[model samples]
Target: MRTQIHSHLQDNQCLELFILEGDASRIRELSHLLNRNIKTVYSKLVSLPHE
Candidate 1:
């Protein structure tokens, strides 16, 4: 179950990274661009592997 959740979270982070097109600034800007809570994004990012 933990692995499954981790996989899902990693997938989400990948999707976010793709959407940002490798742009660090735009990735950081996602909070305002997508109107999502930044902490949520940050948490997922930290949970994922570091490539």
Candidate 2:
């Protein structure tokens, strides 16, 4: 897994990145919980095609 954070020009805001791997079900669950937060400005979930 990888994570990154950067300061936003507005100063009051910032950007965050989280790369998660493992069971798809757990990932989706975690992503859902994160998106439910009122502080999350934007969120997206992307998965690679199954091999």
Candidate 3:
């Protein structure tokens, strides 16, 4: 897991990035949860080719 946080003191805002790996279904479920949260400004899912 890797993450990064950015804060804007002037606007009192924060941005976050979370990189996750696992089953596609599980990831989609988590994405839905985040999107439902008002705090989530944006969310994206990226899949890499695997054997």
Most lDDT-accurate candidate? 2
lDDT of each: 0.42, 0.81, 0.73
Candidate ranking under lDDT, highest first, comes to: 2, 3, 1
The number of residue pairs in model 2 that clash at the backbone is 0
**lDDT (0-100) at residue 26 of candidate 1?**
55
Query: Model 2: which residue pairs collide?
Result: none
Which ranges in model 3 have alpha carbons more than 4 Å from their true place? 2-10
33 Cα displacement, candidate 3 (Å) = 0.6
Please give the distance, in angstroms, between residue 21's alpha carbon in candidate 1 and its true position after superposition. Answer: 5.4
1 against 3, candidate with superior lDDT: 3
Model 2, 1-51: lDDT tens per residue? Answer: 656566675858777777766789998998899899999888899888667
Provide the lDDT at 21 for model 2. Answer: 66
TM-score-wise, the better of 1 and 2 is 2
Give the lDDT of residue 2 in candidate 1.
20
In candidate 3, residue 36 scores what lDDT? 93
lDDT per residue, candidate 3, 1-51, as tens digits? Answer: 555566664466666666766687887898799889997777777777766
* Pick by lDDT: 2 or 3, better one: 2
